[model samples]
Target chain A: MLRALRVASPLAVVALWQLASSLGVLDPSTLASPAQLARTAWELTRSGELPHAVAVSARRAALGFALGAAVAIAAGTVVGLSRVGDAVLDPLMQMLRMLPLFGLVPLFIIWFGIQEEPKIYLVALAVVVPLYLNLVAALRGVDRDLVEVARVLRLRRAEAVRHVYLPAVLPGVLVGLRQALGLAWITLIVAEQVNAGAGLGFLVNNARDFLLTDVIVVGLLCYAALGLVTDGVVRALEWRALRWRDGGETA
Target chain B: MTGTDLTTPVVAAAHGVRRAFGDHVVLDGVDLEIRRGEFVTLLGRSGSGKSTLLRIVGGLDQGAEGDVRTGTAPAVVFQDPRLLPWRRVLDNVALGLRGPDARARSTEVLDEVGLAGRERAWPRQLSGGQRQRVALARALVREPDLLLLDEPFSALDALTRISAQQLVRRLVDVHRPAVLMVTHDVEEALLLVDRVVLVDDGRIALDEEVGVRRPRRRDDPDLVRWRTRLLGLLGVADA
Candidate 1:
């Protein structure tokens, strides 16, 4: 019943939107009719333009996200494990984290130019801080008793981390990853819109310039769909990794 | 599972141990010794430092002004069970075993604790007593020379506590570790431990040895007398 409601509610909204546009209660020029938007989406799909644009944006987001997450995990683990690492990195990380990603976009563009590099760099910067912060919090959240048990058992450093720390922090890290994915997708769209060539964001920018409301609507829908797909993938991975936690109530 | 050689003398000792946090003294100038294979209980009121002393002896905390020496690493089971939430029962038990043979040893210990078929269960899925049992198994899997328990059975219900107490007694008899368990319950201390050490005002108030045989009955005359004595020392009347 919940699933059916989810499907029905969206269809109802689309039907109301189409009826309003046809009755001139809503202007089709500013707010495109559902049929007009669908026709434009179909045209873009037929020409293979939409797929290419989507693929470019996805590739950039995927690469940037992977790089950012990897670095975050490594840095977070080091800071989490040692007092010296925490002392050295935490203050600087805090300062960097407070600076907005868009605020650094111009600096990145100045340094890396109008090429794909700046866009990727912007997305990476946008995603890394949240991932790192979440991972660090997760690592610190590990139970002290568990760490003591590892010490009493005489487990080596690597073994202790693998057997005790990693499993404990995984759920928190997944949450951070989900948040970072959303941020990365939003950042990618904005970054691509800024002096970019051929991506979904570029399509949206061009459509806006020409007052092509249907294309703009299509671009926005694509962004939402991409966010949903990425989130779904992350959730699936989390479910697989944390199978042991299924029957247990979360703390 | 053989008895201690009886000639090994003291397996662990604390000399002039004193611990303080700022203005509050938790343990003050305490001395303790545990003979090999002896089951000792440190019984005290909540603020009397029984748990603090146990932590110092277990090497989980450093005392401010004393030396502690133990021949082997001492494994501890806290009052809260403290099982890692993300780990399976077998994996939690396996945390105490190192190197190549850990998995097999974990399985054996789980079996020994009567949780053989529930190795794959998570800690939260288990009842309070069962989680405590897993904690016990983790400690036992290491075959430690010293086992320090800090009010390990205090969280269980009456029947479960009794059964777990019986299980611990049997395991101690078989494994023969020098065990030091901290508890607030005088009856439970008397029922499980061979020697009872009472702590009061950051000092050892009483150290009495129970000379009873294995499978001690709670209603035994000697145990009853000892319980009465211990209650009097704690300034509480038996109900």
Candidate 2:
């Protein structure tokens, strides 16, 4: 009940703002009441423009996040397992990770020419560092005693990895994915604003130029809604994947 | 017994086993022979390297020196139950088994350990004693010729420890694995082992045989005598 109230409180505030604006107590042109934003969002949805923009942004974010996470996890595992791999790649990765994704926008635009390639590359760059760091830490945190038990059982290297290491590192990987998802969305918005021909970010940018507060409000709300939806999907998948983890009880 | 074959000794010999971690020598030229169906407890103080020796015997560690020649691979139970948290009780028990027979073997072992109805229970849901029983089941599932127990019941409460010890005794009687348990508890050592080996300064100081019969009472005169001797050998003043 408390959780539901907390969620409803924000919407209630928006409703109150709309009512106050409709009563002429507040300027709708400056603030753009919730009702106005809703009407604008409905029109955009009916015209299929909003849906197309959302589809493009979602595809770009999903593809970039998946590719980045996969590569980072593989690289992190190699770096964690071998001393040579760690020594050779650790310093280089640390340097690259320190470089901000937005700071590389100009170079990305120059290289990829303001196309979808640059925007996707920006999203990947934003996500890879956190995923890599989390995966490496997780791999290092694998229990030595568990490995010893596997050795005593005479488990083959592959069997040990499958039965022990994978399960042990899963929680850490999920944490990274959660963090990466949020960053991917934020990066997608920024990349779209700068280079995207179509997206929620492009819509918001277009509204700003025309002083269309309703469109701007609608775009921002859609971004928040998209973030919530993606996070929900990831969390649901995490719960399903780690069902053996104390029956989905949060630790 | 139908499956009893007592002609050959289970663990052949431990010849001049010397283990050292850098400057500190844990086991120094230790030689011992464990015969089939013998409950030999290695009693020592903390850091006396009895656990280290047990690890070497269990094939979990390689000694700095010496060779352990055995008839078959041993199954070990650590002080911690070491059950995989993600695995069910039966799956944890089946950890040591191979191929398709693992599930049936695990169920049988769980039944033998008096946990017949707890095959689907998770490790976290089990009590300390029950977890150790699962660990025992895991070892027994392999049908190992030698069972190496590294203070398996030490972490449990007194009541739980006693019951677990009794369970181990029953399992040993039925399966007849050559058992070597390392423990710091002298009374627990006296209660469980057929022969007690006192280790001090990285060497076996005393190897005494218990003449008392099965289900021996703690207050037995024979046990009292052996305990006194063991305490003296361990440099503990008699109470």
Query: Best candidate per lDDT, number?
Result: 1
Q: Which ten residues in a row have the lowest lDDT in candidate 2 chain A?
A: A242-251
Tell me the spans in candidate 2 whose CA falls farther than 4 Å from its real position.
Answer: A1-4, A25-28, A241-251, B1-7
lDDT of 2 by residue, B51-100 (tens): 88887777667645897865486888889988778777887777746788
Q: DockQ, in order, for the candidates?
A: 0.40, 0.37
**A23: Cα error in model 2, Å:** 2.6
Error of 1 at A207 (Å): 2.9
How accurate is chain B of model 1, given as a TM-score from 0 to 1? 0.94
**Model 1 docking grade:** acceptable
Q: What is candidate 2's CAPRI-style docking category based on DockQ?
A: acceptable
In model 2, what is the error at residue A211, expressed in angstroms? 2.2
lDDT scores of the candidates, listed in order: 0.86, 0.83
Give the per-residue lDDT of model 1 (tens digit) for B1-239.
22334576887889999999988998888999988888899988889998888888888775457988864868888888888777788888887465798999899888988888888888889999999999999999888889998888989999999989999988998998899999989889877888888999899998767776656788999889988988998989987
